[model samples]
Target: MKNIVILFALIGLLVSCSDEFLEKEPFGELTDGQVELPENIESLVISAYSILNGQGNEASNAFNSPASNWSFGDVLSDDAYKGGGGTGDQNQIHRMEIYNIDGQIIDVVQKWSVLYEGVYRANTVLKALKNTTDFDEATKTQRVAEMRFLRGHFYFELKKLYNRISYTDEDGNYLSNTQITPEEIWTKIEEDFNAAIAVLPETQADPGRPTKYAAWAYLSKTYLYQGKWQLASDAADEVISKGGYSLTPNFSEIFIPENDNGEEVVFAIQYSINDGSPSNYNGSIGDRLMPPGGPRYPAYGFLRPSQNLVNAYKTDVDGMPILGNVDLTETDNVDPRLDVTIGRPGIPYKDLGINYEESWARDLATYGPYGPKKRVISANHPDYLPSWPYVTAANYSIIRYADVLLWKAEAEIELGNLEEGRTYINMVRERAKTGCYIQNLEGTANAANYMIDTYNDPFDSKEEATIALRTERRLEMAHEGHRFFDLVRWGIAADVINTYLEKEKIARGFLTGATFVAGKHEYMPIPQSQIDAGGKDESGNPLTTQNPGY
Candidate 1:
């Protein structure tokens, strides 16, 4: 626990908020005499947790979060859907077909800056743990494990976003300003996760702390990105086979406020109104996504589900979601997951007892579609007093067993073990009632009720199976910030993204719209301020060029 103290001191030194908070310098002035070695270590670790979750609000709620903005690039470039924004207008995303793209570039830059700020805090905590002399040996080891887990987690974000980034030393110094290859960064990431796995406990006595299973799950993802097919598969399998984690019987139970800290969640950032102050970051993003005055009954929702994403769900033909090869206009029959994932008009709202009539109406006259219910609590509601800062009941899952299952499938496929890969893929599809639903149409029960083996989808080739596995990922993990990177790793960013844009033009009647060209504006440009301030270039630029084209 002394290590916790060291961790706290390090966080106090490194993890300050924006410029305004830093100027006040609440943490820096503390003397050694005032530092409580063991008693305050918990507070320091808590501080780190606060920093990590700080962006969840802006990212998940505001819809302005970097990864989500970048994800727009994905849908725009694909055949899925399109919005109404014309070139340089509010519908700028819609203008992608016309080759007008400058706003996206700006979003990329902002995400990069915010993400780096997160990395800095993690790095600081890590460095502090390394130098602290106050902690005992065992406590120090556990603290180090936690720090490494955090560092690797942040690096994973960097990897997903930029594909390549520089590694910072213990003192927050860049060991190499030059861009390391993705493979190289993966090496460091793999190393950190492995270390974290070794040191983190299997289950934490505290709610928000890291555990052994969490480390394993995170490493599994890193391996997936590295194309270490076997490693990724094995790590995911490890979580299931040995990590003592399980799928919660009911999906809604996983999200319920009371069920938080339930057995199924391996790791989630615990948000409590009582534990210190509530983070505005933890406020309800789901409510904010709703159209204004859409449904105060449910809460502040603003983000409308794209028609394309909604269409991914298919009707249960024989108890499975048969993939429909229809135009975007057809929505009479769709997959159950669509209802579970995103709300749509005309879908019966159990809570509201009303059906949304217009598919595209998302205004005051037509309340937002009621499918994917926003899980966050609203502050403006009558129950929430002004003194009681409004907060959502959100336990953001950094890792989940479903992802591990998908990772395992990908690994087996890449290893030339198609049969093993099929097992994992079918396991997921079986649960979703996808493909040949003949086995479980009732849709009333959990995994046990579904009989998935009746329909066997064997891959004709490794590539075929790989595509299927990735497709499952898209459906399974959409709106969770994994789609953009999935495109990058497949080397399909240019092809997939551009196709989406063309599809939107044809479907939305926005032909001559914007196009998402790769290489030219794939990743975000390095922040201009960082460049002017002499920040180390994570992109390995010669400091002359502005990332190919500004």
Candidate 2:
């Protein structure tokens, strides 16, 4: 949390509209004393939730700080390309795509800023709630709990992306970046979530508010990241057994605007396309660059799926993954999720009238022809906006039920509970098997040799189960922005990415010498600007030390 968090608040509102309200200073604003009222303080809690979508009051490019993590998570991984007009369009991302990211990059700066803004807002609520007198005791505690949940979320993202980030709360708001140890940062994140879980309700009247299970799901993920296998599995079990969430039967329907907060979503950043903010800032603005150009929906065709990702879908006769040398030629069978996840050359684009053609892609020569599908709302839907800012009311889920189930599987496998893990993995696979299959232009038959099946269980070695679990997670969460961090945590980033580059270079020449350096490239550097402004240590050096090679 920073000392610069605004102290004023308006009653009964919390969102992008509040961005405008918060910007108004001195004239026609409530006094700092007036803001201590119960309703105004409650409004502060809601305002904390607004920053989750990555838009600050400024009109700067929100795509650079996209809550979707498309640029850092997907493009930096083997899953996507910095797709658009050419290599020069949003070139900072191009440098990021090739693993040549620098501390001065716009994304490096803005992402750090936006996440800290979230922290600031959350801490503001926590600080203000402590002073309010008229608010109901239980309600105040509930608001405090929600703020902690949100604060925990922001720090979790920072830890994952930067590895060792500064930790803060209202109590120690101005602590230097190096004040906490790496282990202490994780402990702080756990503390926030654990505190929230003790008070947050199982259900909220508002869909946007995270419930107890949401905190538990995140705690499970936090433990998984740190390799606390038993704790991770136990946390995941709490969500699975008690959260009452299920896999949305139709995988394709999950991303649709109407189902944005459906049963599958454990917690999500709620986005509203026409939310009365003149600029549509409350919409998923950070992902504004993702909509692929086509006859029906025209927008920047960025976040293009990579050829390597498409090939990973290839399956053998038993509907199992065929690891290396995945031959996409000869009508080879591929997982059905491939069609549900990526818009290929011949598939009907999200059930819109026209088929996806090569012309739909902005640069066929450079990025190749595969537009991302998971986050894209159908052009035919009413929420569709054929313009800027993540363009739809479709909420970006921070944690999905399937994701929690997989976390359990991953933890179980790591904990040597192979059979239990296999069952959990199969639950997600079973949904894909029976739920949906991509159909042809007329919606007559399977689009591509769709052949996906569940894995055979029992007595399999941890190695085989681990492979199956990792493959399932990649296929399920491909473009929603979890791939790169997953690879890094598994300690296989260097091997996986270098191999991907070696083969991928044959098709996309831009990746000729790209390499994922072991210790350094796993985490992005602390922004140069942050280091300059973050004050100094006792020895007259910058307080924030740069991550390894940076």
Each candidate structure's TM-score, on Cα atoms with residue i matched to residue i, is 0.77, 0.94
Best by TM-score: 2
The TM-score, computed over Cα atoms with residue i paired to residue i, of candidate 1 is 0.77
lDDT of 1 at 123: 57
Top candidate, metric lDDT: 2
Q: Each candidate: what lDDT? A: 0.53, 0.82
Worst lDDT 10-window in candidate 2: 1-10
lDDT of 1 by residue, 1-550 (tens): 1011112234545345442211223245444333335434544555556544434222343333422332343433332222221222334333333445442344444455545555555554565566666767798788778878877877777666555455664564554324455677888888888999888888786767788888998988887777877778878877989877665555434555555567667666554432333333343322233221234332323333444455454444344334543442342444444544554444433233443334434332222233234243233433222232344545556666777888888888889988888888777666555332211223333211222222375679988788668767776665554565677777787776666545544545444545556775455454454444443356655532244454
Q: Which 10 residues in a row give candidate 1 its minimum summed lDDT? A: 1-10
RMSD (Cα, Å) for all candidates, in order, is 6.2, 4.1
